[model samples]
Target: MDTLMPADDLTDELRAISAVVATLEHAQQNELPDEFAGLFRHDAIWTTGGGRRLLGRDAISAFTHQVLPGAMAASTATYEVEHVVFIRPDVVAVKVRQTPVGRDGVPLPGVNPGSPTYVMAKEDGRWLLVAAQNTEVVDG
Candidate 1:
């Protein structure tokens, strides 16, 4: 690590993380199950907003394939990285804000926003989603 902790390095890492989130948005927007599923680690754990638990990449892939297609035909979701906490040089906790919007670029009413946190780990020079928990933000 550079003595400065390299502001440039931090920026680069954030950029890469942002790119990953963008890829996730693209995959979901296009309903590409394979592309969406490929972002996770082999042993990744994911819990859906509806509270369904998915263990491992295979399970996640199956769920995506089953639900992703035709899921976006009605509306599209955009994910924004709201905050990132660096757990270590190679690990991070990412908070994403997900909103559903229509073709006209307006948010769909009655659809609660998503507050998901993705635990990402860098391995073999690549960042992968190691664990994720998706929670929908609903009004009390």
Candidate 2:
């Protein structure tokens, strides 16, 4: 079996991913669909906050351009990856927490801390999100 990557290398990779997340955050904040769409693959599928699924480059772009900006109107959405494990140099799985700010720039309720496992890959030296799914955390 192959051993895990070194801590330093993992840290660097995660940092690169963090930068990609930051870039997406900025594009969403600025309502830049073109820039946002540029971050993902043409055939990528995205799960929306409202429980809808978006597929294909055109659909994904349209969905974001139509819905996300309004849902997050005058708001900001930021995320932090809680954990990242590299399966290979090109593939990583990540657990992330998303926080959305209200129109007043205050954190909103029902933003209920959620977790999503993301599969990311480095394409042409840029980290891109390829696949992801939200994890439900139920407490009894």
- The model with the greatest lDDT is 1
Candidate 1 has which clashing residue pairs, if any?
none
Q: Write the per-residue lDDT of candidate 1 for residues 44-103, one digit (tens) a residue.
A: 999998899999999999999999989987788889999988888899999999998996
Clash statistics: count for each candidate: 0, 0
Per-model RMSD to reference: 2.4, 3.0
Deviation in Å, model 2, residue 108 alpha carbon = 2.0
lDDT (tens digit, per residue) of candidate 2 on 1-140:
24277778767777899887777777877778877877777777778655677777678788778755555566676677787777888887777776667656577666565566677888888788787565443330
lDDT per prediction? 0.90, 0.72
